[model samples]
Target: MSWSLKIFNKFPINLSSSIHARAFNSKAIGILGVPFDKGAGTRGTDKGPNALREAGLIDEIKHISSNIDVKDYGDVHYELMNTNGRKIHNLNDLSDVAACNKALADQVEKIIKDNRMPITLGGCHSIAIGSISGVLRTTTPDNLCILWVDAHLDLNTNTTSPTGNMHGMPASLLVKELRSNWPTIPELEWCKADLSLRNFCWIGLRSIDYYERIMMEQYGIKYFDMRDIDRMGIDKVTNAALKAINPNGDRQLHVSFDIDSLDPLFANSTGTPAGAGLTLRECLFLMEEVHRSGTLSSMDLVEVNPLVGDVRDVTNTLNSAKAIVCAAIGSNRSGNSS
Candidate 1:
């Protein structure tokens, strides 16, 4: 929180090498990485975890506070299950998605049991299936609420997805109400649809599939799109979303943040870039406010594909990602006293 830290936020380089750790709200953060990207069409999104680390994410997060305890549990590893070359219709890499997410769920459950807030880095947005599943293992579905921040609904099922990407279908897979919508997948038997759409709220949505929009209306899902943010302002919209999902502020909160929620102008390194998305400042405020609520128990920062752009684009996107993670964990605008 020193001047150097604030400056580092604006200019990542040019900081004094000897800068010291600052005081911050106490947190025991458990970090996990998912290096599998078969859920999406992009090949490089699997490198998202390492890309953030190489950019000094751990060091910067450590620098945020002397009181914060940071532990990296390393990357999640899973082999693609044998499918005998018989692929499900409109569902790509179903076995691999099942394999990776099941392992991810087990590891995440362990982290939560150890009394640490699990922070997962993503290979793609599909990783949410495991991350949220892990949390549900320890916490009751009714006791937890989710804030899904993304430019897209990600609500398509195998029946509705145009691209056949598993990443676009995680939302549907995780919701209990939509269980009937999915056919029996022997591979994904490990994942149960326990969480309801009623406990979930979405923000920053811009591009939504036709069926997804209809489904939202049909289910009466709570959400705020870009136009809502534009009309109501981010602060009001965020507060409304929070109140709608976690009214009385008694429920534990989980945030699933997709990098594509950010505008392409700022985070073009992501696989799916939506124009006119949330600005960097708005994104920071949303995360920081969630932290301030003292109810945030877990989060997923996903969809950062390093191979999608040039070096500068990757750098900016990673910086934005680090900022989002830090803010969610209680980083603030005020600098540590020098």
Candidate 2:
């Protein structure tokens, strides 16, 4: 009945490092890399996980809380298959994406069952489909709330998607309210529509499509864009978001952060870059608040395409991603320990 026993056979855990033994550990953090990019129209994001690891994500996080046990689950690889008979438009590599997400879901579920926090490194925003579903396997849907930090709404269904990129439709597939609108895709049948509109909130959004905007308004999903962040500040936005989604403070928090959520000035190595977005300070503050709340159970930091940018741009993007991850896990950049 243990989580490990149930799902480990499906997705084996491959620990890439043992640094936790040397650190002062307080909690266990499970790192799972989904090295998939077929979900997006771009190709470089598949390298994001290794790029982040090479940038010293584990070391930096360990420096913050050496007592925290960090276990790297290596990377999940998917074999590409011909989609000659598929019917979904703009959605490429449907089979491979589904397979990768299914494995990711199993790995994430097992990590939660092992009593560890899951930190997923994305191949694309579509990875949220598996990561969030994995978390749902371990807990009830109502007890979970998702904090989606991105520039795009990512609420497009198969029929409404302008770009058949699976990354743009994760929010739609994950929410039960939009299930009826989704086109029948057999590859994605394994995905359970466990998230509810009430359990979701958006922060740092800027480039929303017209249909997505309509859907958000129709569903009354709470969202704060760059303008709202400027109007109310990141702290106020974070407070309002947490209050709206996890009102009682007892629900589990799953943060799905797209690197594009940060302004292109801060993180420009992503596939989709927006002009004005969350500032580095705002991002860190938001993650710090989430860490302090003790409700953060899982998170996905996705869409850092190192191959697209020059060395300096890559460095800025990677460092920004690292800082955001560390902040979520309780890192204090001010050198003042709480």
Best by TM-score: 1
TM-score of 1: 0.91
Each model's TM-score? 0.91, 0.90
Model 2 global lDDT (CA atoms, 0 to 1): 0.83
Identify the candidate with maximal lDDT: 1
* Candidate 1 regions with alpha-carbon error over 4 angstroms: 1-26, 82-86, 336-338
lDDT of 1 by residue, 57-111 (tens): 8888887788788999999998777767766789888888888999999999999
lDDT of model 2, residue 212: 91
Write down the RMSD of all candidates, one decimal each.
9.2, 10.1
Question: Please, what is the whole-model Cα lDDT of each candidate in the order they appear?
Answer: 0.85, 0.83
